[model samples]
Target: MPSRQWPNILITGTPGTGKTTHAAQLVEALQSSPSTSSATWEHVNVGDFVKEKGCHSGFNEEWQSWDVDEDKLLDELELVQQAGAKVIDWHTCDLFPERWIDLVLVLRCDHSQLWARLEKRGYQLNKIQENNEAEIMEVVLNDARESYAAEIVVEMQSEKPEDMEQNIERIVSWVQAWRADYGG
Candidate 1:
């Protein structure tokens, strides 16, 4: 890995764990910070991209299936390499190449809070139940560990934005330290 080359940091978690919010916060912070300016950062939300591009359709016509192209995404990883830093937002981490990732932040949410959030979205009972159960089971964290090496960090996020801010603080400092120690 080149020192000046951008670092790809993945922020993954179950739905309603605030992955998107945290990703946006981290990206904004990096762009505004003046400490180190060798690279730019971008937040890529895989699901949003898939939905926007209309990638896959399945049994539920209302809900398009997510069929991620790992190779294509890995090729896009080169964009982060060129930018020198990125905060990737995605629910699933196993889709990307582990070698290309510098760090993984797995956001976690309590099952009750997650269920409430999902309910607000008006998801079908079955989908909500499935997601709630997944959160309770720590599916996201398990998936991250199963797919990646031993450096992933897991943090919990409450329903409140303040809690999300705290989570972002931890990540911002982590990013700064990683860059200081690993960057040129």
Candidate 2:
């Protein structure tokens, strides 16, 4: 694919990792950071997008989440990507083809923190155990590494307020560099 006017950022991780929060902040940061070029940035939360676009087959009782139809979801997002910049927030990353993404941020949190966050969210025992194990095993991180080129994938800690602020600053700088290199 030809270079886009702006980048598509995929924020992925195990469920309690603050992917949504980071994506939202990134979009806002990009918009207000006084860049040289004009841009249209957005946060695309895949779980919500799937349900809104009818790209999910049904709800998964076991996981208490939607059973997304991958093909249908991807088909819709292909059009969305054509528009401009996007910060896609999801628990899975490998499903996205590398060509469609400019950056892959795999957010991670400590297992104890993750467990507490999941519990706070009212996740059931099975769901909580599944996510906690995934975090411990670095499941999302491995998936992101295997799917995208190493240079484009960044692993970041999302455990505290300071970490989030630092992440946003770092990513914004990266975006500025990207825009400069690619004529955004």
Candidate 3:
């Protein structure tokens, strides 16, 4: 199959917005459905991938996260992108080039729900506040829209289990549609 026939999806949002959960569930669902084609889809956790691939330049003490070198990360992602049908899970969206992504799903959550989730994860007070503020300001959503075309960027709320299920089903349908359109 041509590379463009397989869609590359990016699931991005603030830390507690359930991006990884959704991406994993979606991959499982797609894999189980025999009708969804034999082409395998990969869930690429950008954080873990960065560490495993040594794409970061250094560590950030304040955030307790890697100081990712964007260029290096992109270089590493090139090979993964070529594999196609990747569910790229990450917190930041705009760093990736738009042409490489077919869809950008920016998961969102209620501020209170997000705060509770972050607190449950044992995030520092300042870190929680920073994430809450970013969510409230629609930082990820805005960045996704700016980085990709409006038609391809979707902002969906993920505060409940039902929402997660619905989102997964919706994305499955989208993948099927994409396959039909692109001759996957």
- The lDDT values for all models are 0.73, 0.89, 0.90
Candidate scoring better on lDDT of 1 and 2: 2
Off by over 4 Å in 2: none
How do the residues 1-184 of candidate 2 rate in per-residue lDDT, one tens digit apiece? 3478777888999998999999988888888878923687889999889989999888899889888899999999999987658889999999988889998999989999999999999999999999999999999999998999999989999999999999999999888888778853
lDDT per residue for candidate 3 within 1-184, as digits (tens), equals 3456678999999999999999999889888877675878789999999999999888988987899988999999988898678999999998987778988999999999999999999999999999999999999998988888899999888999999999999998998888888744
Q: Distance from true position, residue 61, model 1, in Å?
A: 2.5
Q: What is the lDDT of residue 42 in candidate 2?
A: 87
Clashing pairs in 3: none
Local accuracy of candidate 1 as per-residue lDDT tens digits, 100-125: 68788888887888888988978877
lDDT value for model 1 = 0.73
Query: 1 or 3: which has the higher TM-score?
Result: 3
TM-score of each: 0.84, 0.96, 0.96
| Weakest 10 consecutive residues of candidate 2 by summed lDDT | 31-40
Output the worst ten-in-a-row residue range by lDDT, candidate 1: 56-65
Error of 3 at 118 (Å): 0.6
Model 1 residue 101 CA deviation in Å:
1.2
